[model samples]
Target chain A: MESWRDNRFVFWLLSLPGTFWISLFFIVPLSVLWIYSFGEKTGITDVAITWTGQNYGRVIEPVYLQIMWKSLWVSAVSTLICLLLAYPIAFAICFAPDRWKPILLLITILPFWINLLIRTYALLAVFRTNGYVNKAIGWLWNGIDWLFGGQHPFQPLELLYNNGSVIAGLVYVYLPFMVLPLYATVERLDKSYLEASLDLGASQLRTLLSVTVPLTMPGIVSGVILVFIPSLGAFLTPALLGGANAIMIGNVIETQFKSANDWPFGAALSFVLIYATFGILALRWAITARSKGVEF
Target chain B: MAAVLWNRTPQGPLEYSRRLWLKLLLFATFFFLYSPIAVLIAFSFNTSKRNITWQGFTLNNYVVAWNNPDLLDAFTNSLIIAFCSTLVSTLIGGMVGLQLWRFRFPGKTAYEAFMALPIVIPEISMGVALMAFFIRIGWLTSDVGWPLNLGPIIVAHIAFSFPFVSIVVRSRMVGFNVQLEEASRDLGANQWQTFRYVLVPFMKPGLVAGALLAFTLSLDDFVITYFTSGPGSVTFPVKVYSLVRRGVTPDINAASTVLIAITVIATVLAMKLQAPTKAAKG
Candidate 1:
């Protein structure tokens, strides 16, 4: 078959619009941000390119570093929890009847399509003092009190506006990202291997740990990347669900651009997130490459 | 002994327990996913002003949302932005996908990596980046009148959304036979004619799916839109976010339910369109 190179005019025509649009609108803007990171603020509305390292220098300050560390901790916790919950769900979907697969997959992905703001708002309704969670617990407490003929009063558990709520929100939001990739890998798994293990007198737990987990490592990595990166930079989740003390790196970056008016510092903070993302991706690539080398 | 045991019964107590555990996990996960949405939808009809308790059912919230001009205007802005961005991104991204698939070029790997950057990076970074770009270019300044409207938001939406379209389109082209194009050419059809009649028809499903995805993403976007939008260009999500900061209201719930319904419908349609291709590949 003739290559598209045989028709250079047509190929260039096809490529020009997309290349131009992405370069101008996408690449150029990100480049601007990169430049801003190295610059300094001149005035209230003016950021001159003074070529200073102060912005990045401030990133290592205790206040900013603490926020960044907290962000990492929260994201890692959420990603780990998402993996634990999603693995079993993915397995169940694979083990389900043939006709039920699509429906199950759709159900897993449905919440993903819903607006993030609305989902967080719904959590507020469910976690507030007068929300459904507290209401249910109160009813249970009253029932026990009546049974024991006691006068103990029930108090609502503070489920909202905390670090725990922020982590819960992240897990709730990114669960589908973890499940979908796992489902794909688990579905494509060779069942014969499991049968062989079982036939060889391996326990179900042992077989799962030895065979299934190793085989599904790719999905686990992809899911972790997908869930962790977004959770790290999550603004709306921490903003709406978290208390005043629950500010993450994303919230700090948002403040710089909005009320703080520190565009140069904000740009630097944003670059830190970008760098972290690149590091994780590079780590994944190295691991995959090493595994492939071993196989060969 | 192993063969005899296997033949006697395929099911063991451990397997049974494992299956039960998986099923319970599945049930719990689904409940976790759907319960909040159910509560949100249920509260849309509550007559309570503060949404703290259920104060009987009424359609008044939907009426109030409909009557609010600002909310309606924001919804209209969202629709316009979603429509415009989807159309432009689908066109540009379709071409890019075709170019990448059909030809080998210098810097192709670099270009592909660049395209994926928008997707892999944090969206907050993208938002701040575009805000800085617009400010630097003077388009976002208070003095700029003509280019200071919805143009920047639409541009940002296209930038982020087009990569998704390219990915979907390129994936759909995998393993596609080139013989169809050769046969059309041999039959004396011109290049444009063959492209229009053969290639476009083949790419119809991907194009539709990509467009639907782009549209849904643009409509659902809040972070990027919030940064790029001007005073007069508030989209639905931005409007909702501001209202949520003030306090949650039933009208917001009504608006959210409507958005949810639209997204569900669009997603179902896109899935239906892509289902046949998946089955064929299988």
Candidate 2:
């Protein structure tokens, strides 16, 4: 049993380094961002500051609002796909033999060590016009195309650089984020409650819904937070896979900082992104508590 | 009853279902994870200079990327930067982790939250801020006596890497018992002796794991390095990015294949070293 004083001293000391670093870099910079959000971008090539809320007002404009909507939609699509993909995997890993479970988990982790850029580029090898996918499709449609000579069957799936590809990219990028937390939760699940339900003649689907799913809701919520935020702020997948058409909030932020000469507006956008992130984290905390039946 | 289905007669439905489905799923899952790397390795040997394809096989791409002084130098810089970032972050993060474990203090919750903010906050924000900070601070400016180069790149790399080391180490440290420290004190050992003999031995695994993670992160990082770095500090990822933008060559694929091989090897070795601790946790 430790005294209050001892605990306080330890925490203060332990926290000092971290606090100092964050305050210097994260806190001050964010504060600057917050303040800049209120300021105006008023210069030609270099933004000169003049404070105003007109930047917030412009967020209501169709262009900015549409960008926000697109970001939300892409993030939602990715989150939905991740949930569909991860639930079964988590379920499978849980039921996997103890000797093989860790090995499977490590396999999922292999992509993280592989360069993210390299992984994204691998999509190129498969989806390229002359790649295996097209070649295989061409094999199926070769007779028709060869006969017609007008290029009807297997025209190489001109489906690249659109919402579908972008969605696929998001799904591929964030799938692991969904898996890690879900894996942690499922691994610790008590099997007895499940068995008792089955013994009482509950259907497989019912047992999953009533016993297993609700029990792992925390993992789901955390996974959503993990996947949703990154997808919302994503730039790489959209830029590489989607096109100029598939810009998101993060791309906007990058443009403002790098080229648009609207630091104040950029700062404002970042503040909004930051606030949205914090809002989600807070909402997750609240929802998790509520799900567990906590009053607070 | 189902046992008979999988017997020597090959009629066992239940045993067949269990074995077949599980094996198939396992294979599919591993293929999903690893097929991308396999594809990259295969493509690296593609001989066609225009439009990537397997035009028979050749190691010419590897020979080219390896022979290029610029790309090889970038790879060396990445290695050096990752090593230094891991070293510094490990030291600082270890100290912070210990302090958290050993001493109780006010504002601890605040500290914890502050530390975690970096993880939740977008990386681009950090990049922009570091860039602005570097320009404002004379040390990074080319006009200043110091050159714009690897020094600033390393500083930026270590900055984020430290927090990771601290976060992982702190979680482990919190669960560690204080009895060892008390026992060491009772045995009349000084603070340094107690730490070096007792505390450090226990913390060795966590520290190493955290450092390895930090190293990989620094090596992989691009956005932060892009903003903070000068002409001389180009990392492997950035080099790859530029290569890709210039219409990706087979050499890029070969270089990437080498990188993937190295990372997998390193991660496996690190996992093997940490296996006992991980098993104990299990």
Candidate 3:
């Protein structure tokens, strides 16, 4: 079949608008940010491109380093939790009765479409000091005291404004990102392989560990990257839930831009994140390529 | 036949327990996913202002939210931004998708990779980058007239959203019969007429779905909008964020419920439009 390359003018006309828009708005801005990463702040409102590494140098200072470390730790923990929770749910959905699959899938995706801020706000309502969680716990405590005739009053547990709450918020918001990729991979998995393993005398647990997990490695990798990257750069979750002590790298970058007026430093920090993202993607690509080569 | 016979056999105790456990886990996960939103929705009608405890049902929160001028203005800004971004992104992205589907070109892989960049990078990076770009170009400064205001925010949204539209439209073009276009041309139609009459109808479902997706993305966006928007162009999410920082109130809950309802309706409509195509394909 002849391609649209035969009509070069029409092809250019079709492609040029999007290309030009992305170049001006997306690529040019990113390039500007890249240049500013090596710049220095000259005054209260002026940033001079002095080609300094001091901005990146400042990133390794103990204070900023600690925040970066904490961000990685928090993102890793939340991503791990998302994986553990999502795997079973994805597996269940893949194996669900045909008629129920759509409904279950929709339920999984609906929260994804909901606004992230609204969802985080909902978490606030659930985990506040006098929130529903404490209310229920307090009620249970009263019931126990009534039975035992205790004199002490019930104390509401402090569930919000901490690292734990921030982690919980990340896991909540990014769970669907983990689930959808897993569901796609698991749904495409061959059932006959599982049956063959069972017939070959492998226990279910053994088969899952040795066979199913390996087969779903691509999905696992994608899910982890999706959840981990967002959690690492999460601003609202930490701002709303983390209070004072749980500041992540994202919040710090935001501070540089908004209050500190350190555009150069913020641009440097943003580049660090962008580089990290590229590194992870490259690692995934290399792994996938190696695995594909092994198939031959 | 063997598979049917195996399915008819009774499950052992271990298998039965495993199945039960799986079902329970699925139930618990769903509950975890949904219970917070359910609580938020329920409390939107709470009579008390604090929203710390349940109170008698009232519609006053919604009434208050409706009457708040700042909230209304922010919401109007969001709608205007979403509409403009959606329309432009869809048209530009649709053209890109069509070109990608119908042609082979040099450096195609690089072009495709560049298109995916906005999606792959963290949004904060994009937000700050755009902000910096606007400032560097003097578009975001107080003195600039044309490129100032909501222009940068709208541009940022279009940059992020058009890639998604391209993806959807391209996928919709898969397995599309090119013969229809040939037949239309043979019927004495010009290139413009063929596209308008033949191609547009085939691409309608995808276009609508992509538009809905873009609209929701723009409306729900906070980070990009936060950085790109000037003081006069505060969006709904930015307004809500400030309100949240001040303190949680039932009216915020009321506002949130309305936003959620809009998003859910848009998503469901997009899904409904997508469902028929999948069914037909299958």
Candidate 4:
């Protein structure tokens, strides 16, 4: 009894700091999410408290619907690209010699901890007209001119502010997240099952279809969800590298608050995003869990 | 069966093709990752009217960028804010993690999940909400009310970063053997002494890691800081963004290269030091 009392005391004491922060910062803000979504806009910036679904109604308007559709399409493409890129890298690391595995994983993850803003700017330098690729092209043109041809040559494509740039930035930023979980999932997979398929005289392609893909479904699903969720909300990369036209839902939400001076609408937009992301994530989790049970 | 996408194995003839494919894939990936970063680093040293055109190799931009007084001031402000917030949140999170890890309580799971939610939620919402809250209560400006002003900015940073600290620290606490605490008490060491000499030492790595994450997040933040921070409270990233949006200049490139170098070095050092602690999700 005495020991249990001491345990209780220690537990309660340790929990105090986390509990305080969660209540004061996190829980309060999240709870206020629904409130903000329904509140009324008074002055341009201020959201007056009055319950209504008017904001949700406006979310269905064609212009806003277009923005939402674009956001969805971009996120879907980004997720698909991230999955294609991450899967093999994850497979290689999982099967690599144990001594080499850690280093490779570290290399894969190294770029992630660097500030995203800086990384995005780095891409900016590369994509700019007079940047390194252009300079190298100029050098090559001069070389060709000196050797055989007469005059100077072609120009930089100016890849900035394009969909390609935005996709590049997202893939760069989120690649490691996709890789890490896939590696974790792949490493734990048993190899004996593959050997059994081979013994049955099935082709590698057949075994992969019948066995490996089925096992790694969770990783692929989770990876898709992880990449998709954040891409939907990205503001800075789209704002900087994506230029004006490729505006995301996050940029739309920001406009509501800053430029549009429509706080209630901004709040509504945020609530919509949060709901959509969480709702999709939850559905995926449920499906995965159900599959796990069936597999068991 | 090589499930290139569907299976994890290569067929007899496809094995060679697959190995060649992996090599190409790895090279392409590494190129995709490093080319942009290399461009930024290279341009920092370029001497030209145009940052894009290489007139000659020089350190002119670095010299000018570093010498700027406002940039220096912004760096100092960011450092101070990050350091303070990291320390405070680490301590707070450490204690909370210890509690949750050690005992059962009502609402524990809900709280744990709630604490973890900040990581996945959009930072913009958290930043704006905190800014709104501070304004409504008159905690924003010294002239309006409150005996002291750490300013609304610091409060906002502390609030947003609080979740990161707790989640990281709590996960660290989860892996430590609870038997140590029981053994310490059995040996006659009191609770405080056991925590001071043993439990804290064990928890130190996670706490420090959590602190590092908090510090970096605070330093790199722009959207959050823009809303919460007052005049004279610009973070380095926010300053860089404004500078970038205005125009492309060699000075910004120099500044960016230095910042990237710091982050890269810090990340490598942390990874090296903590390699053996049973790697967990990032």
Candidate 5:
């Protein structure tokens, strides 16, 4: 009985620090944000606590709507591209020889450790006009000129400061996020199923489609979510690579908090984004649950 | 019969093409991932300050980065924040991991979920929410509120990194053998002695790994720091970001190359430590 009491005391002592820090810094702040969303902005740093839904209604304006749509589609395309690129890499790593598997996985996650800003800067240097890429292209052009007796100088394509570059940056940054989770799932797959499919007269492609894809669907879904969420809220990539025209919802939220002096509107915008993201997650869960024939 | 049928089937053109396609895809994916970083490192050596066009090679860029006072200050600030947060969070996280692993209590599931929540949510949400909470409660500014500086930034770092440490330590504890603890206790060792002599040695990998992860995450953080930090507290990533915005320079490239070197070395060490632990488990 005395030992049981001591154990309880020890448990409380152990749990206090983490619970206190998280409650103070994370949970309270989130609740505070939820409360602020319903208040009205009175001044630059002050807000009135008159409960109003006007801030949320502003989210439907055409400009905001257009930005939201662009953010969604751009993120979707990046997620798709990352999925396509990562699937094979994940497969290769999973099936690699035992001695090499860890090294291969390590290489895939190495880029993730590098600063995102630095990586974007690298992309910027590579894709800049008269940069390394264009210089190489110009060299090739000179070769073509020498071959064909044509003397037109090569012109650099407009690669940076556009939607395409933004998407490219997003895909590069998020590819490891996609690959790691997919590798986790694919590596753990039972190999006998592949053997059974092959033995049943299925070709490689047929077996991959019928066996591998379905089994790795959960990974694909998770990879999509992981890539998509960060891409949707990406401010740095679009700001650095997309120039002035390719602003995202994240840029708007950032401006509101930093320079726009409209905290209420920013809070409302954030809540909208949070709701949409959570709603999608909940919906996906429901669909997955239903598909698995498990009722809740 | 199956052997005869397998011998009769020859590798077809389609199979050959498919194999070639997969090989090309894998090659392209690796090239895409690696070439930019390689180019970045190479250009850091170029003497030119303007474009990435070939210039005379020199190590002057590294010297420039090393000489910049603002960059050095930012680097110092980042180190301080990373160290403090890593220390506090590791201590807290070790305890949390122990409690979660060795004890059963009411609301354990809910507590676990709460621990993992910060990791799953978008960083922007966490950043803005904290900003809102800080400002609304009069903690951000000194005029009408509390004086804010590195305090909020450190708190935010500790908040986010706490989960990472807890998760890693919990996984390590899950693999730990309970017999060692019981044996040590049976031999008349006290709780502190058992923890020091037996548990600490056993949990060293997880503790080191968790601390390293927390430190790295604290160092790499920009968005959360940007929101929570006040003037004069800009971290290294924040400084690099502002520099990138100002213009492209070989000095920035040099700085990034240094950053990349540190992170790569750390990651390799982490993998080395983690590999043995994982292998032993299986």
Candidate 6:
């Protein structure tokens, strides 16, 4: 083996380009954003470094707090629904026959290849007022009316441009991110252990709860993180599917930077979002570590 | 025989119901996953422009999208940017992957955590951060002269895309057997020759997967491109977003269909290339 010192130069040379790019594009900008959060915007396009903390204060106000709460609530509900729906499917895939397993997994993951924008737009095609779903509902209602000699036709349900649709869109987009990890964990589970449990007179329900659930905790956590963080920061889905009242933290940030032109306040709002994300992740880690009796 | 009968008789109907429940769950999940895309693909052929109501089926939307000059230009820009960014990112990411796999260095964990930050960070935050960085550094608004153009967009794409490439390539490299490299070197091969003849072939699947992933990501990306791209640098997704915001048009659906088709083809090809590596791992 080559001496460790000799490889050091090669390491520096190889890593320099990627490191430089990330630092310039990611690190430096995040720092700049942090600094900007302290500055005050003096004019339409200019921000003066005032070292004031009012921007942070503004973010914690009742109105902004309400938005933040709404964002969190929506994301939590979406993540919960996705987990409920994905777990069963992942379980099925884990136990599927050899001939059907790959196909089932592929069907679950293939939607991820499509662009999120296109997928959301597709959701619109289904949820729109005059869309296919409402059309079917109208047809069914008309059929009932004809049979019962009703005088009036049924009106379409208001599905699109609502908070419910927004959450649905989020769940639809993020289900795969939840499923793939859970599938891997479930598939790699020790079958012998499960069989042993069954042989010892443990019921399937007991084995699933006492053994399988505990084993898959890591997958469940990862799936939650992957789904929740993005859902929290979701902009496009809420914009397209949510009505006037569906603004989230992401939309506020976008509005500040793009329309309001308040870069400093925008930066402050972003810092809050960033901190919230890190805080949630760290809390989860700490909780998991404590439960496992492991040093974090 | 007693145990078998005991197993069969203990809540027999319950077991059957559980199995049926699982089957139904799988079916419903698949339906939810695919129905939106199926709807989009089906509606791309709809003759209705303003409504989702079925008119007579027609190929006019595809023809319209094809003939649209602005959409075509956006598509061209996306292709060029994706190509250039993929090349640069893959090259740098490959080197980084090699470095990460081969060398033991001080602060390696720190370096890795830093590398992983981008993947975990929200895209909007990154987009805004990069946009702010561009403006603050006078990359976009220099008193001397304007430097921001397609250059910043390409740089941003490389930044995001390279991390993915590095992760994929590095995962493969972790499982790589170093004996093959040593044997190649022992057989009178120079450094370049060893890399060319041994490492390249070993890394072929990973490299292809990384390249395809980077290409699709660059193509599908909207948030970063929206923030970083100047007036002349609108990509296809950006164009699609704008069209979508204006109204639901059949042309957008047609464009989306084309985009979906390309990504699906790339994904299939990547899966085929990756199958061998997966089997080897198993």
Task: Give the number of the best model, judged by DockQ.
Answer: 1
Sort by DockQ, best first.
1, 3, 6, 5, 2, 4
Kindly list the per-residue Cα lDDT of model 4 for residues A68-120, writing each as its tens digit.
99889888888889998898888777766678788888888878876777887
- The residue pairs in collision within model 5 are none
Ranking 2 against 3 by TM-score, winner: 3
Model 6, B60-161: lDDT tens digits are 999999999889888888888889899998898888887777777778888888888888788889888988888877665543322235677788899989
Sorted by TM-score (best first), the order is 1, 3, 6, 5, 2, 4
| Model 1 error, position B49 (Å) | 1.7
Candidate 1, A141-191: lDDT as tens digits: 999998988688888898988899999999999999999888888878888
Query: Which is better, 3 or 6, measured by TM-score?
Result: 3
Q: What share of the true interface contacts does each candidate keep?
A: 0.72, 0.32, 0.70, 0.37, 0.54, 0.62
For residues A34-126, what per-residue lDDT tens digits would candidate 2 score against the true structure?
766677665632344567887777766899889989999989988998887787777777677678778778877678676677777776556
Candidate 3 structure lDDT? 0.88
Interface RMSD of each: 2.2, 3.4, 2.3, 3.4, 3.9, 2.7
lDDT of 6 at B281: 88
Which structure is stronger by DockQ: 3 or 6?
A: 3
Looking at candidate 6, what is the lDDT of residue A98? Answer: 77
Off by over 4 Å in 6: A1-4, A143-152, A287-296, B1-18, B141-148
Clashing pairs in 1: none
Model 5 chain B lDDT-worst window of ten: B11-20
Q: Give the Cα error of residue B125 in candidate 1, in Å.
A: 0.5
How far off is residue A281 in model 2, in Å?
0.4
lDDT score for residue B136 of model 3: 78
In order, how many clashes per candidate? 0, 16, 0, 12, 0, 0
Location of the lowest summed lDDT over 10 successive residues in candidate 1 chain A: A287-296
| Docking quality level of the chain pair in candidate 3 | medium
The reply for model 4, stretches above 4 Å from the true place, is A1-8, A30-33, A133-155, A293-296, B1-18, B139-151, B279-282
